[model samples]
Target: MGLEPFSAEDPIFEDEDVLRDSHKPEDLLERDRELEEYQSALKPVIKGARPRNIFLYGQTGVGKTVATQLIMDRLQEDQEGYDNLYVRVVHVVCKNLNSSYQVAVKLVNEFRGPNNKVPTTGYPPDTIYEFLWEHLKDVDATHVLFVLDEVDAIGDDDDILYELPRANDNGNVPADETKVGVIGISNKFTFRDNLSARVKDSLCDEEIHFPPYDANQLRNILQQRAENAFVDGVLEDDIVPLAAAFAGQESGSARQALKLLFKAGDIARSRDLEKVKEEHVREAEPKIKESQVRNELESVPTQSHLTLYALLMLERQEDLPAKSSDIYEVYEIAAKRIDADVKTDRTIRDRLSQLKLKGFLDVDEHNEGPKGGSYYLYEFGDIRPDMVEEVLRDVDRLEDLFQKEITSY
Candidate 1:
């Protein structure tokens, strides 16, 4: 019946924002090689030539976006001295924009600003592209570099990718007035690999790949961040190393490492502890993983959730690494329980493959020589079964199904 009083000034964190994704460090550590390559990719911009359409691909939490920001900042600042060159950098995050149409509209809105913003729909793709080109011309810059962050979210609909880089050649924008370029950033490596040949040839004029950090590199990054995030000496000696090791061993994600440090500090602060200790880091690991799994699940289709839930059922029954057929059976039952449509076995297999690609499942292909042929086995990947079940149970339609216990197949 009592609320704890908020502390006016107390320990754990000095500046928590530094540990977050939004915080852009002045210098990127341990990425000199990649940065050098990235600088080389952007060198044409400084010389007042047409900027290359740069493609940056890497796994999540690698410094792709951060590095792009740093280089973009430097590019803009350095270009200021060039009297003949007027450079403008436009950044658009395509995470929520799923298609080329949507991305073009987003760019149009970004270029047009608030007063002249257009609606999200109703415009044809060509019309949107026209609007984008007109806005690019109106900006009156000598060179315009558009940074499409999370460009993979546009998926296979890559019209913007193909068209943007060719706006000058295609005469959408006159080359003599303003030259346009694209700097696409993607966390998914497969996105670049799957691009159509024409789009790849246009958008990937210069490609830079960022490798994940190792444990030592992660430790160095953590130390740099912690120096700004946490109060001096409040973090135990082993705290940064432990968090870095957890993240490095798993995904080598700088974001995950920072999340662990932030969560551990949060735990310490909640307990009113003076220092973030090793135990706090250990305690934050599963929680961070669960949160990550939950966030990933939020984006997946409902059918993928059902497929994963089916796997969870098999995992609980110790029927792990079950075949797609077996998972299809469970998936049918679960789907029927919620009055959802039961997809075909082939569709379930497709879902399984997608889940595997998303790191939600581990798939093994079994070759059974002539007669037995080949089949695939499926099971949970790094994510735990309990975590999947817990997250799935939160789904409103599936909550009732989870209440019903199925002891047998």
Candidate 2:
């Protein structure tokens, strides 16, 4: 058969960009309460007072970043009434930035412009802070807001969070020239709880919590995007509700809900179907979940992969909910079979703990009476054993192990 020709006209999508994460809607829907609290947090800026350091906490896809962008846009437009006030917002996504020094360098580079960018390393932490302060003075705005997205990635090195909020009081920048405030956005619920007392006091002056959207709310959000995303008659009546139910019951993430609808549309267009039906959305569910699992698996270390593989083997033999000691035994054999370095049992346990934290494993702790000790049992969490095996096979070193079926010692 000849190669299929490209379609002359597309029928499914009118404006596909509307469904994307980067697209910001003019108004946030179903977020009135959170938005009110958010507006109240920034009310000081309009009155020519220093802006409060705001902490926005929520699970992923609950509209934290989008809501912030919406408020910032409105704040800029309304500030026109005040002649003396100047407001500027600098956004930095710290997902890959791990230390206070790196985040400081990023801020300095943002203020210094592209041509004056600094290397990621080779600077002392104090010098970086000084440079940041110098650049803040140069901006010369009455109030400057730093929106640090995924601020939890900085981990224990939270000096940037503590310092930026106190830049004026600490004499880093003159109090009259530029007042700096930090707005930290984190998807990790424990990020705020893990902050040091001093950092919490300064950075979390005003906290706003965004709860996950329920089914009705997800349906409304999906319907709004669907109007702009697909051609008017392309979506069947039940499409939005089914997608919303899946996302609402599973994650309650607006982003996830939107993604499901987008994927279903693509599937319909692929089959050259006129309308998106229930089957299309049903098919899209597993594809989206598999993609999410693969992306997460790629982020972990190789040792973690071996640890998970060992669990997969035990699960296949109906031996799951196994203890760490039993897992270590299988893990050691798998490591040797692949000719990989064998980690000590303690180290293997650490890898197991890391995998558990990443949501790849479920763990239960058991304790004996007073004189006895405590131990934990492990099994796959949420993810299926076959899915874990499939993804692990993609790793070059683990490929041979799967082929040889060397699961037993």
Candidate 3:
């Protein structure tokens, strides 16, 4: 039976998420060389050679994620029936996890099945690590692949990266055992340079660098996404260049280009238009910018979180490097507005101190002449006042959605 077509006004592709996720690394195109290289690196481990640790460095959105997914897919397919091989690939994004303890807890939970739920906070690091090792040992896998993405975000916690590779190395391996490997992927090239010398020697045994995508690469990537997202010939010829140019101009990020293309397509389809246009692409720029700001805010520490909201309020109300007192007042107001507990001024001051340490906020010391009062002026380092305000609004809106459950629980 033929399916009835929707009215002419209805869009061809009813769902928008399909468009947004079309260029995901799993669905990535034209990266066969990289896929092959990474596969070759893993070939030794699959053949039972002592697994090695690898580090993948790349700029954001340049196909690091897509290439990793593609290679892992092939690895799984190739190793389907190797009973002696316990090949566990755990992927964790370190941005949301600030401490090694949190990362271990996440890893343990991922390794654990439904009956076991690890605690989120307050488990001693040693206990968590012990539990994780036991879980790994229980799985009896010959190879364990820990894929730590954005490793720098772990915030000075290098314990997991340091210990995982040496898991079976400590003489208790029954003299012969299958090995473990680590794959640490990061955008920060200097992350290893900053790590302790011991960590440097351990986790970075082998390295792969994924350079940013060129304009041609971005075009090819967008073309691949376009094929899956739109019906044949629905996307205009200019859309690919426009998306690729904008994305390449920013950071050679295929993800960013694909996001713009997806958004532009959404705009086109929403208007019941036949093709994406330059106007639609132009309109998507601000949306992407806003999204980036919101994501940054979400990743900031809780103290910096409140400080940003306070700074925003002060800026909107008056010019600022706002006196510490004025900023505190705004913070209190913001706390009440968001229904979060109002921390003491001392706590807020500590937050400001940490922000300064992290280079997000500047603290200017002032000493009045003779015995007069002395204090420090507070202001943001790189974040803008307006962007701060917008992120605060987004935070408040998201909080509103969950406030009831929060209060009830």
Q: Which ten residues in a row have the lowest lDDT in candidate 3?
A: 400-409
- Work out the TM-score per prediction: 0.87, 0.84, 0.72
For 1-409, candidate 3 gives per-residue lDDT tens digits of 9976766553434334554643344455666666666777888877767767888888777777667767777777777766566566777777667777888899889877788788798788888888877776666567678888787788567888788767777532321443667788887654656777777778877778787787888888777657766777776788888888888876677777878888888788878788777888889977875675467566664555777767665565565677778888877765676667778899788778866664557778888987987889887776676666556556643354224322210
Tens digit of per-residue lDDT, candidate 2, span 16-129: 899998988878899999999999999988998887889999988999999999998899999998998889989899988988889999998987767788888998888988
- lDDT on C-alpha atoms for all candidate structures: 0.88, 0.88, 0.71
**Tens digit of per-residue lDDT, candidate 1, span 312-400:** 88888899999999999999998998889899998888888878887888988999999989988888888877778778888776776
The ten-residue window of minimal lDDT in model 2 covers 292-301
Candidate closer to the true structure by lDDT (higher is better), 1 or 3? 1
- Model 1: how far is 168 from its true place, Å? 1.1
Tell me how far the alpha carbon of residue 134 in candidate 3 is from the true structure, in angstroms, after superposition. Answer: 2.4
Model 1 — which ten-residue stretch has the worst lDDT?
A: 293-302
Candidate achieving higher TM-score, 1 or 3 = 1
